[model samples]
Target chain A: MAGYPQNPSGYNYGAPPPSQQYYSAPYGVAPPPYGQHQQLPYTHVASPYGAPSPSPSYGAPSSSPFAALLPSTFPPGTDPNVIACFQMADLDGSGAIDDNELQRSLSAYNQSFSIRTVRLLMYLFTNTNTRKIGPKEFTQVFYSLQNWRGNFEKFDRDRSGRIDASELREALLSLGFSVSPFVLDLLVLKFDKTGGMNKAIEYDHFIECCLIVKGLTEKFKEKDTTYSGYATFSYEAFMLTVLPLLIA
Target chain B: MAGYPQNPSGYNYGAPPPSQQYYSAPYGVAPPPYGQHQQLPYTHVASPYGAPSPSPSYGAPSSSPFAALLPSTFPPGTDPNVIACFQMADLDGSGAIDDNELQRSLSAYNQSFSIRTVRLLMYLFTNTNTRKIGPKEFTQVFYSLQNWRGNFEKFDRDRSGRIDASELREALLSLGFSVSPFVLDLLVLKFDKTGGMNKAIEYDHFIECCLIVKGLTEKFKEKDTTYSGYATFSYEAFMLTVLPLLIA
Candidate 1:
């Protein structure tokens, strides 16, 4: 409530403390501070004296002032290396990368993705304005990518450099996907091309699986064109209607 | 960048504009304003002028300013209805409800959940201090329930008061669960006791499935003790080890 004691009975309500209420207005814009000396992290220790080049690439030396202050990896601050990656990926020179462009570029780096998955990836990784991922959004992408890679490696418990079916399921589960064991098997079978049942999911396969599952769920819903809150599927009907999509 | 224009080359950067750089200290605390007249929505009309009773309950008239401001429903904002529910459910009067208490209360509302599922629900629904959920969290619970209910109704396309297999799949997908068809079928089969393949899932069953899928994923992960990213199970093994847990 507006006037209740901010803290009552040892509960810390979300409302700002009364002393700091003046500036904590809901949706109110706050000003910036420019008084502090710039601190460059090891990953962002590029020369600050160089002039901006005509075609600046990631990690390329540039004197954009902003480039010099980008932090390295850990804190995921504005790092020049990642900013350059974004700029390079913005192939249309629109100053913002749409989902398609980002996806294609990421695929080049072995992170293949379905469009919906890419959209989810965008939602998870970037802070977009009107779905347009600009430089600011790309900084978050760097951080998110670092996180995704870490998760991938950690879950690849066998150290096989690839996650097999069970591991992929765990990864999806941790990512908040409430997948079933049978579905997990189907996913691995669909994507895992190795001859034996021991087929595994590489990084690209893992990303693809995440997206395909999302896509298939929507596809399944579409079959319920009657809006009956229920749809009947016999064995023949499933083999005809759904099997191709999964294999495809 | 430390002092560059917030927007350059038509690209919006996250840095604050130079105009307000002095006041916008990074992570500076702001203050609140009390001068504005309260603009209560049609939903926030409260029955004021009532005195607080010794044992106040949700939606019950009370003199507490916060209670007076809580809304009945719709546009969920600090509604006393949910707060009262949380209070009524807080059996020990500890000023905070743990997962067990909340689960028991939710079960009374027909939203039964496993301990693991309840923990996930708590994570999704409340802001806790050392996992103790207080009134502030109950408000969030109201909001989350409202959201879940909305998602449920939306996917129950036929208005049949229940969701079928495909519909359930869509509902789960919308609920951020990338479920598989096989799993979807199993869920419906588990909940829809009225035999025949065209089983439907009511609200309670749907929530249970969401929790079950999550719980099962955790259980499956536990079986992968070797970190091999692969677990072996014969049909007999599955029947003995997994099916019973699911039915239970």
Candidate 2:
């Protein structure tokens, strides 16, 4: 479905103002009202895949500290802050950042993505022939991370900086996932930070979990074109399809 | 579904007997009968995802030229033929093969996969953190490719060495992908060898098409856990989810 551009301009790399630390909101505290942020241009466009309808806003800023630093050399529509981030991550002055650099950079920013997640990001954003991502892809990766961050915070309703099982269910629901309780439990077991005791998911693990679920479900749906829960696969097709996401 | 281990031993790098050129079967000719080949062990185990009963055999061989050459240093269960192929592809003697090497090696074998297909293969089989795939991953890739080759030949019903739209429909169905006519048309358009005029897909393109469809379907199914055929995505989530498979 069509979601509003959560953060059209880009993600803010600078720390949020003290009163607006939505990510670290204390337990039992509600996040700031969504209306407080500046509204983006309201024009809407359908995704090439024909996604439909706007969902609720996840808190996203319309501007960033690097907004005014756009260099003419980059592609148009490139996010300046993304370029800034990419440059910072390209520690070897090689004009590109590999997976190790990406992981270190995100961790530096307190994102702490797993090596797997960083690798997936690199696979998606870079030429698969190489491990490095250039500025153009870094822009897309940056914006996508910001979008996911907004969604994660929206679901961390208790403001404890993590989402418990029920919050995860609601979060997934908003994203159009109607997973069974069994599947939800599986997800919690897969991503839960407390090893199934608390059933709570921190941000990085949540992204990895969601990406895998979404990826696998999509593959199954291709075969289950009639909407049957059941789909068939040859041993090889099954292995080829599942192993990449599961083991990679 | 669980499938007969079509090629449990491994793919044969040596040419098949001249009389059994199944891949180049002329139009209107049937492939060799299924009973003519050596049978693998009849054991069956459910996939972790609980796939169902075995489908028909896909004409995989139970032995290969390199089977007797198993290296002492490799992991157990490692296929000798796959390791041999990996070493041949590792032009730099780096103990691994990168995407370019993979594409070149497949081409040398007359597989002629597209760069994009090679990228996806690398993404699925290798550590995403590096562009290189080690012997262990190469073994999986080799087996998976042989499996896909069997499936592709199975659906090339006319023995024309390529699949047409209707054949593709049947092929997808055999894999439990009951795609609609519109999607079938789209797939043909996406992979057609004659620029959509013939609506035919070569063997290499067929694998790529199936991989994309399978990957995307799996992703969508995660959100459509209720099997509703519809899923919602935040704008960023949508982009992140689809771009990797679509544009990578």
Candidate 3:
């Protein structure tokens, strides 16, 4: 898996802007409409990784009662800012990001969260006992979801919610990476699990693949500081450093 | 293990100064005297990863010869430049770097060679079939050997060829890192295979330990960009990123 930043600044610790702030929304209630995309009312002060903020007055009966950490104006629809963080935490690429990975990913952002605290957060956000949090469900956690939505809309030219190999190539190139065809082909084969060249890449897989490639390329460029087109590496070095970028 | 640069410039690729050059003295013979440190009379152009330059006129009976890549006059004895590269390749903390690691390490210097080529270089340098190459034996390869020797000598304060934990802590501090006592203890426990707290750290281990600590601390500082001094992480993140810096 890709590594996360191990500093507090990596996480946007700024207090939520007033427009996005709301009284702590009780868990599991149909979110009160905050116009446009219905955002869950979340309190800015509550820790993102901990139990939701307490709202004694607005006690909407919730099976898994916990304070909402994200604001009601949390811009809805997938956030791109969360993609790299999500991919780093989604170690296995199973599409179901678990509490362990989430907790670890948060740590990179300098968020201190106990596993129990993460479990509670997961329960509040997911509303079911299932340990895995799918991509659609994860969107409920924050306003940065707008970042993902915007990126996906920009890339999904056909509005199909999935981008194909050619589109993926174009998307990455637009992101300023000169990904070789061989590497692109390898990536498609590795991540396009459905095995058909005609298949469009799903949102989650596309995000994961893009993030991994970008991160690895950055690492390669670090060693190739002289701007050499290629960086020579022994098989072992390749295995230890580069392989993780490719295989994971 | 730490990573190495993959550019010639990354390896300090500038041509050697006139004072360090000498005629090809032929391999396996005592390197013609170059003042205090006997410098290897390597061809100015051989790849750092392969056989000594094949100067047919000099007839250096190389087991597996290759094109000259690095400059002929490799600087002599303990130059500080090679410490990070050597530490990166010394992955296992065995205090003995092997051919595989060396070759990959050279790749970061923009040199490419097959395993057979590395084996031949090792043979010419040590004249032994042993798999492990200690620091003294490894110095025979090139003038850059000066970097490693110089670094080791600088840190081996008592002239015993080993550095104690206090010396290591000081070395890291001088390198501009604020290493905590807890992290230092953990690092010593992880790398000190000899299992004695009173034991002084040998040259290779000291370099490796320092590199690992520096690398991890840098990663932490990246997250703590605000100079907050502390960054919190969940247990899992601690395991994936920070723990590897400590335990690996």
Candidate 4:
């Protein structure tokens, strides 16, 4: 049942450098390989739960024939990187990982990170169709946010600049989260710290926000006393500062 | 790291009764071979956090040393089931299982069917100076609890009929739960459902509460539209329903 989950064995990336140093670097750059992420593009940016409709000025994508999103029994090529990502995404201990499931699986830990925005990024990056996503596909989408913005090659599901709400909703559902237009509204507001109706969510901004959220969450877990990664503040503190936000 | 964190390799356990079906009739428990809990007791009680604690009246053992608690480490060639229980207690993933740590961990997961009055059991079970309990010892304890109502092999380490505020506070810390005396009092009022004057806080009860908290938290997470695992309804329900009967 175990042996790198799925993939041909003996796929060695060669020996790593003896010294393993920490990467305390800032965002926008990739981490050193062997577990760190390099930035790339993705498509299908999730809107807020209550996002405003796009204006007519922003036209739809160009139509072209491409690899359509559908169930494919064909084996993903022998790439260890893609295999690693599959191992993480294929929850339930299953060998094959669907794209939609990736969001739910990643969201569990990602939400553990601080800041409310990772949830938004989680929705954007996950593949909703068939619930499985190969590692090669996931990396480019994750570091770059291919779904919301970026080039057509990454998300051109059928090579179109368009993805639909069902796809986005399934991505959220796989991770046990779904953004209604209401949640979408909140997402857009956070994306637009400037308060302008930015109208569309793009790639670079998505990656920036995702990294910030993750860093903050790691710091927050250290403060939680319950070992469940939550701040165990007293009722008084929680009520005065935190309760209002949840109720709202 | 994935193997027994407490017991390194070189441990032994007979293969499963290939004759036995894995899930057709229960996961099958055979004194938890391979971890520290093998010597402890087992119960079917479904509380989330830890093993169940025994009550005050449970009588002491005439056979084992040090009242009731088992030795942290058994002689080599110990049964696999015994090893399993001991390993479970190595909460921090350290290889050793100390008496203090065992009490906290068993109490943390108090599987309801585990031996009760854990603090007391811990006090009574340390038959050796190493002050630790291995799987054989833990599984034995767990089995005894499941078979009997409660056993005296357990008593608050201090030997008092009940756990006072100070004793309770100290016990909490030794287990990695850093709560204030006030918080402890609140737990007492909530969990010490039996309003006795010297409300002795048994280790089993501590575990019961943690499990309850975890269960409720999980439920709230599922119930919430946001998947944040938060909500006023969940909060009030937890404080009002679970808090009173389990804590101070």
Full ranking by TM-score: 2, 1, 3, 4
Q: lDDT for each of the candidates?
A: 0.46, 0.52, 0.43, 0.34
lDDT of 4 by residue, A1-248 (tens): 12222223311112121232234221122222323332111111122111222232211121124324432222323336545655676676655454346545544632322222333334333312122444433443443443333322243255432222233223332221222332333333334424434432333333333333322232232333332323433222322222111111
Q: Candidate 3 docking: what grade?
A: incorrect
Highest TM-score among the candidates is held by which one?
Answer: 2
Query: Every model's DockQ, to 2 decimals?
Result: 0.01, 0.04, 0.03, 0.01
Which docking band does candidate 1 fall into? Answer: incorrect
- In candidate 1, what are the lDDT values of residues A1-248, reduced to their tens digit? 22113223222212222231111111111211211232211001111111111122333322366754763222233456876888788899877788788878787854566554566556433322133576644654555455456757889887876887667755654443334455555556545647336667677667656544433333333443443323333222432333222212
**Predicted structure with the largest lDDT when compared to the true one:** 2
Which parts of model 2 are misplaced by more than 4 Å? Answer: A1-248, B1-74, B126-130, B225-228
Give the per-residue lDDT digits (tens) of candidate 3, residues A1-248. Answer: 11112223322122232343333333333332334332211112211221243344323322233425422221233346655555666799876788788767654543354454455446445544345675534544432223333555677887876776556655554433334333444455545546556455665555545444444544454444343333443222322342222111
Docking class of 2: incorrect
lDDT of 2 by residue, B53-99 (tens): 12222211213566436422345444567667878898999777877
Question: Using lDDT as the measure, what is the rank order of every candidate, best first?
Answer: 2, 1, 3, 4
The TM-score of candidate 3 is: 0.26
- Cα-based lDDT at residue B216, candidate 3: 45
How many backbone overlaps does candidate 4 show?
124
lDDT measured at residue A36 in model 1 versus the true structure, 0 to 100: 26
